[model samples]
Target: MTTQAADAAGSDKLDSGVLKVAGVVVLGAIMSILDITVVSVALPTFQRDFNATYATVAWTMTAYTLALATVIPITGWAADRFGTKRLYLLSLTLFVGGSVLCSVAWDIGPLIVFRALQGLGGGMLMPLGMTIMTRAAGPDRVGRVMAVLGVPMLLGPIGGPILGGWLIEAAGWHWIFLINLPIGVIAFVLSLRILPKDKPQPSESFDFLGMLLLSPGLALFLYGVSSVPGEGTVAAGKVLIPALIGLALLVSFVLHALRKEHALIDLGLFKNRNLTISTTTLSLFTVAFMGAMLLLPSYFLQVRGETTLHAGLLIAPQGLGAMLTMPMAGRLTDRIGPGKLVLPGIVLIALGMSAFTQVTADSSYVLLLGALFVSGLGMGMTMMPIMSAALASLTHQQVARGSTMMNIIQQTAGSIGTAVMSVILTNQVLNSPEATAYSAVTQGQVPASQVAPAVLDQGQSSLADAFGHTYTIAVVLLALCLIPAFFLPRKRIEKAPDATDEALPVAVGMH
Candidate 1:
């Protein structure tokens, strides 16, 4: 063959390899994301089944979130110490085992405990998957590959509730956890066959002190934030005490990281302009987006008087819009850069949130659905591109650490958003002029059916106003995210070969 023909053949082999790696990794990613959202929809069912109080049963989610936060700081070191492929498989095994236990759980306490084990596995899957894919794709193709990997993130939230509701109504709640078994098994088997072997970095040492400080710190902080929704105020002891301790420990870890040559995660990565800006943008956008997501369901179920399954279906359009735009956004990010796409995306998200601010109790379904669709489109355009740009900014050696830090920030931001929005919505509801009147109607002095029309109208309007205020806050937060997007690089930087890539087989062992 001529020289040109040889180059074309090699290029085809490279493209094929990228797709295979992305496919296997995405299966694991989908399982983790699906499990999180799916379990959420079943919380009420669990409460009834286990005969547990709301406070106790709530730990099913709280434990998982805290465990996930605690384990994330250590993933970078673990990935480097063990091989990435090996660690990825181990995470899947732990997750699958936890799911099995959860399926058979006899009570709330056992289920919560098992969910934490599941979180440990789920936590590592995301950052490790990203690190593996980033290294495999090389920086040049990071944009397109990250976009492909992002499909699970986009689809999971949209599909999880719909699927969970169907399973619970048609099959049973056990099916929610049991369903993960087959997917996890298939992903594990495929990964072992398809993933390239990564040689462990023996020179890397574990930072025991850093781990002790950071892990608990993250857990406590997330726990404190999680308490806000239940407690109704950050001033409550449950929220205040843990948050302060968590802050102190986190500060100490930062100081320790700065001093150590090889810390758990290199805080020094902040020096990279592209990475710092991208991280900030991602965190702010997540805060705004997550808060709105929490509020939307309550609006549908409580104010609009929709059923659980119906509310889940209502949210589908947003995810659909995001799914539609992501591939195009990914290509654009690679061709130009994140800057152009992310700016417009943020603006579009803000516009969508803005629409919610004007919503009334009787707003049209078509109007709300259109707004959600636009917001989803904006999310698709923004999230993966920023992720792609952040990973692209790091050298191959820095991919593991960079991926971990990004996940940590995103998780914290989500917790903060949830907590903040919960507080705001609760306060609005309590302080509304209709609160006392609504309380009287619910006190059983009169049947809801016989309550005066005026009283019913006031209650619905109050709830709608409370939700609208929460959405207004979300819009403002999303608009603020644009500031960081300005600082992202206009084009992706070409990556140089690193020592870590030396042990990998050609085309990452593609057949």
Candidate 2:
């Protein structure tokens, strides 16, 4: 044990034991992250199988996201209250059980309910995983470990649609949920055997008041935001009423949190300037980047008449580009500071996305792919470094709470970005003279080539214009991210003196 501790303390490289724990965390993360995108591609399949409208089927996604938002505010407290190892196992159990139930759901309503149940578990996985890894890696190596954990974040979007599309086409929609059974079981078992036993501090009182306010507030606000794309206007009653109520509750929570030491999310963490700037930067980057990412597959399917699988394949270059830069950026972040890497990354992203603002119906595939690859390269440098900068400066005790806050900001920002962009594109398409033909192409009701040539030409042009205009907004948002990135710490972060090196047991019996 002394030898193991000495080895861990002496080395900067990740030893085998830490890598094993990372593997466990990554597996759980894959299951949680992949579920979101996997289910998205299966939505149309749900509509067909359950004989439901698109709006009704969309609740499957909305319900899952709402459950995620609702459960997230409580996770930091829960991890400390319940041992992380035990809670992690329970989450895996719930998620897998929900997956099983979803596979057998008989109606759209049942599926939506089951998906929310799944999300209740999924919401905790990433943040919990972050806490575990942060502890295991210690503050000095957080940048590298965070980069390792970022694998699924990059892979899920690229792989989910392809996997989901293939499953839906070859087997059935049920397999999409059923797929989690094997992965979940393996993750559960590995977690039990590999992870360090939890050291829970249950002394802090649970913040029930904060929970009541923030959880419902986030769910309601996001619910209203999610409604915008479908309703086509934020002024609609359904959008306005719930959003206003949610805003009121959120404001109340903020005021209430300010007075309390142990609020649900610990709003006081914003006192850390690094965390504040990083949070702002993450919010803007996710809104612009993720929102734009969602639109790419849609573009290929609608304008280019590609299969879901093909669209997913086409988007792979961006992920591949990210893959190229993530590891190098991680190492550099540990040696330097995030601000240096992040500024250049944002610039590259803006440059890559600039091409999309000029997209035409027959834009060169090579050119588009090159642009996406460049954007991916920028992503590799940007996302996790910001995360590392935020958490590295926090005390070991505060890592869980800090990660929770970051996750909440990310979820809310991403939802808003998706909703806002969708509305813009939807409006642009609807207002076009070729609205009917373009709508048919987008909805998969008709192929662009099959339409009258003149109409196809004009309609495709109109559709491209809408997408181009939307990309312009996304680029502007990316530029806004640069303002915050410029402020991130540029020097190597020092470890907090209190961050003791408690090396994890290499195996179940070794300690």
Candidate 3:
């Protein structure tokens, strides 16, 4: 915020101008986070309308994620060099443009390409939002500001599918992308009026090599995750081998970063005791969270013989659970520290996933809802503390890299979670022995025409005995998350900036 640097210089007040800016950023954050899940409900419709395979339709989501992961490491420099306002506005423009382009796409190929562009824009919003909120509220007020920001973060994914399901059924898939236009337009216009202008300051050289290694590494890794479902064992290896290669590149990037004067992402952030532990827990949590999330819809669609809207609606309770309890969790983390609260939250998540064990062809919907709510509550309680703890550990100067690293890990884990689950679910679904044995257990009497769709849940019911298999795996993930909560300290913690850390202006990044 070098342009407004003079205005904001040396002042840590949390009143008037700063608070107003914070409100606007929150609105923008909602737009960014909500868009990620809003597309979930729309995916079924997109596949049907485009006459494409599930593999092709998935990129509408996957490409957006890949694009975001690829570009986020560079954001600190982009913000530092371009000023938050300029970069923020540009990100808004690009997102809005991508949304409009996505609405007009004639085929799966073009739509996915366009969505990646949208992700390119959307990815910057959260980090930028964090930068703005943190800088405005200052260090002392970070917890409360983050708690407020958590609303959209938790709400977007929780509500996205149901909202998109209703919208797609009522209107069409195209409207999903079209919905972004007006909101984006208003955000763009208001941004010009209110966002602080920070001029680019000359500083360290951009680490082209680190980024080069990191980007393709992430791209290939996600690509492999997406490809795993379709490529059966032989075909799966074709995709996985490249994924291994991609990881090797990331390892090379780490080595390259360790040796550099300034890396794309500063490896030094990891040396902080709390940062290391917090991020480790976060990655595990994401794997469990995302793996369960990915599994639930497949359960409904395949085993339950539900419509897309029906399947989407059934999953709403998880989000409901999260929204209901997250604020309390955030405030609790602030008051009691993350340690006391997170363990119970992880325990709740295990309970919630256990509830899934009861789900079968004839399982009660009401019971499923209860389980999801508890699961959501647990995730709600767990995610924010880990994040708050991590953020609490960082100085304003290190916040950008810290946030990117967290985001990257969460994203990567999500990709891996779904892939691993897919392998489990798919292998079971396809095996004639398991499939036939499952089919024979309860509903063996049905004719082929009477058979439920080979979707995840219906497939399970067609073979009713396999429900425990998936849930068992989910429980292991939940327990794994709980085990690490021990590393968190028991009281509200201080992030005393290290003496060795280089000092820089930790200005708010606005666009």
Candidate 4:
């Protein structure tokens, strides 16, 4: 073979190797994300199966989310102290083990505990997967790598419900947890073979005080936010007290971090313009998108009278649109930068959100599908590029901390969105004239389904109006996100190569 041909072949081999590493990370991430969303569709079934009250069953989700928030703050430190590969393997094991335990759980209490155990491992996977991929792909190709990695983010929410609904119908709820085993095993084995081995940074000091302050603080804050949906108001004592205590602890941690040189997560990274703007925009985008997503399934199930499987399938168009647009967006982001893409993406999202505000009880299915598709396209163009821009602004040493910070913000913002939207929807439904009349007739016992036909009709109309109002609030939130989107950097940044050698270590065995 000619020398140039041989060079081309070698380059192809190197590219292929990078893809294998990214694929493994993406697979593990999908399992982690899918677990949270898939289980959501089974919540009602859990109450039935365990013969438990709504509040007790609800703790299944609450425990998982709280554990996730508590553990996420410590991931960067853990990754640095232990090697990233070892940490990744250990996390995957814990998550899979938790899944196994959950499948065989005999009671609600054990189920909640096992779910929290799952969260312990699941929380670390996202940030660490991103960190691993960013390091392997290097700065020059980070955008494309992120695009590939973003597939799971796009698919998880849309696919989870569909998969969960099917499992419940065909194999029972146990299969939801059981499904993780093969996927986890495959990812674990591939990672052991292909992932580069890094030496642990033993010289790094553990940040005990920071962990104490930040972990519980974040967990409490998330707990407060999660309470809003159940309490139906921010003014409720359950909401206010935990939120205030969390705020105080977070404030103390911020002050401590500002003073210390070796904090758990470096707050100083916010000084980078690109990083700051990208993080802010990403958080806002998540709030808007997640709020709308929360409304979609409930709307279908309650208003349209769709089964969980059908409702989940209805949500798939958005994922389809995102899948179509993301690869192109990733390429454009690498060439022209994130701001150019984000502005148009935000506009499309606004247009899609606006369409939902017009929804009625008998609105066109085609129109809803189209709007969801457009919104997904917008997400594809916006989210990954914004994340890429943030990582591009940081030095290699900061990537781990930066990933952790981004995930925390994203999770927190999503919680806030869910809470705010749920409260708004609940209030609107209760205040509607039809609901007020129907409530008086039924005395808040069982739903109007057992009452007269007219009562059922009135309740349905009230719910439609309530959902419409909730969507309008979502549109407004999406519009507000435009302010941050405009501030994103318009040109690709050239980040310093401080830790690239350590990041992309020599591939040892695979040919």
Best by lDDT: 2
TM-score of candidate 3 on Cα atoms, chains taken together: 0.88
lDDT of 1: 0.84
- Across 396-480, the per-residue lDDT of candidate 1 in tens digits comes to 7788999999999999999899889988988888897574355445433356776677878988888788889888999989888
Return the lDDT, model 4, position 432: 78
TM-score of every model versus the real structure: 0.94, 0.97, 0.88, 0.94
Candidate 3 local accuracy as lDDT? 0.74
Candidate 2 TM-score over all chains jointly:
0.97
**Which runs of model 3 end up more than 4 angstroms from their true locations?**
1-19, 199-202, 234-237, 432-467, 498-511
Write model 4 residue lDDT over 98-176, tens digit each, in one string: 9999999999999999999999999999999988888766665667878988999887988899999999999999999
List lDDT for all candidates, in order: 0.84, 0.88, 0.74, 0.84
Q: What is the lDDT ranking, best to worst?
A: 2, 1, 4, 3
Off by over 4 Å in 1: 1-14, 433-453, 496-507
> Where is model 4 poorest over a 10-residue stretch in terms of lDDT?
5-14
Q: List the residue pairs that clash in candidate 2.
A: none
Give lDDT tens digits, candidate 2, residues 141-173: 889889998899998988999899999899999
Clashing residue pairs in candidate 4 (N, C-alpha, C atoms within 3 angstroms): none
- For model 4, what is the error of residue 305's alpha carbon versus the real structure, in angstroms, after optimal superposition? 0.6
Q: After superposition, how far is residue 303 of candidate 1 from its true place, in Å?
A: 1.3
